[model samples]
Target: MTQSRPPLNAPHSTAQSAPGALPGTPLRSPADVLGTGVAFPIGVNPRGQLSMVSGERAVTQAILSLLMTARGQRVMRPEYGCRIHELVFAPGDATTLGLASYYVDEALRAWEPRIEVEQVQAQLDGQDTSRIVVDIRYRLKGNPEPRSLVFPFYRSL
Candidate 1:
């Protein structure tokens, strides 16, 4: 008898919207990355490790976008609410030390979310240098102390 309200994180299409020219309302597009004044040098390393200056930028942008969105903000309570427990990276080895730190600090700062990164450890799985993992511990609302969420956020990035 009553229609249920859509959750904050529900897809845009599912939300009630004004009528458009088409049969259905258009879906929202992905968030755009902010422009950074810095420029990156072009070229691959002799070790065969490819680097893209915007790699971390793009990732950080996405994370920020998600948090700022209506859905993300709902979950991201400012008063000791939901926070990132940890950020684990792959390639478990000697590489990715600086990269991991940069990503966690920069991205978390941009989002303005309360998350404590205990340490950035390089995990090496065999000879693969493409993957790196870092473990972090933080706290969210309804909990007195910090806990580890172990979010598998990095997927094929």
Candidate 2:
């Protein structure tokens, strides 16, 4: 008989460590160490089970959730959201852009710890006078590759 190796993403459940790796260290899936969570705009799987997001996708979804949600939207978690929505009524000027960038930076730093924020910029959209384009550049704490996200913040004026 032979014991086949589990897939890289498969979770192991053994009291003892993996052979030849480390005496006391337990085997862990790389995906688990990265992260995992319920998918945004969540949907059911083919078998009717809830879908999930993992690794980089999970981090992206978390950041999106933090950005799109307004403070006090959650029933009991009032402080779990960003304040950029408040700028919807403010004038779309340099000061407003600065404030928007500030709000995004603050929210990401406060809510998500898996990634380190690199740069945050708020610029005017070329065709939309009432829109402020927020550009966020960040990377996972241990990874050197960078990722970026663009969020358009619109003002009533």
Identify the leading candidate in terms of lDDT: 2
Tens digit per residue, CA lDDT, model 1, 50-130: 544343344443444432233234545443212222323333334345555455545445453433444433343334444
lDDT for each residue of candidate 2 in 84-128, tens digit (9 for 90 to 100):
999988887899999999999999999999889999999989999
Q: Any runs in candidate 1 off by more than 4 Å, and if so which?
A: 1-95, 112-114, 126-128, 149-157
Q: How far is candidate 1 from the true structure (C-alpha RMSD, Å)?
A: 16.5
Worst 10 residues of 2 by lDDT: 9-18
Tell me, by TM-score, which candidate is best: 2
Misplaced by over 4 Å in model 2 are: 1-30
All candidates: CA RMSD in angstroms? 16.5, 6.5
Clashing pairs in 2: none
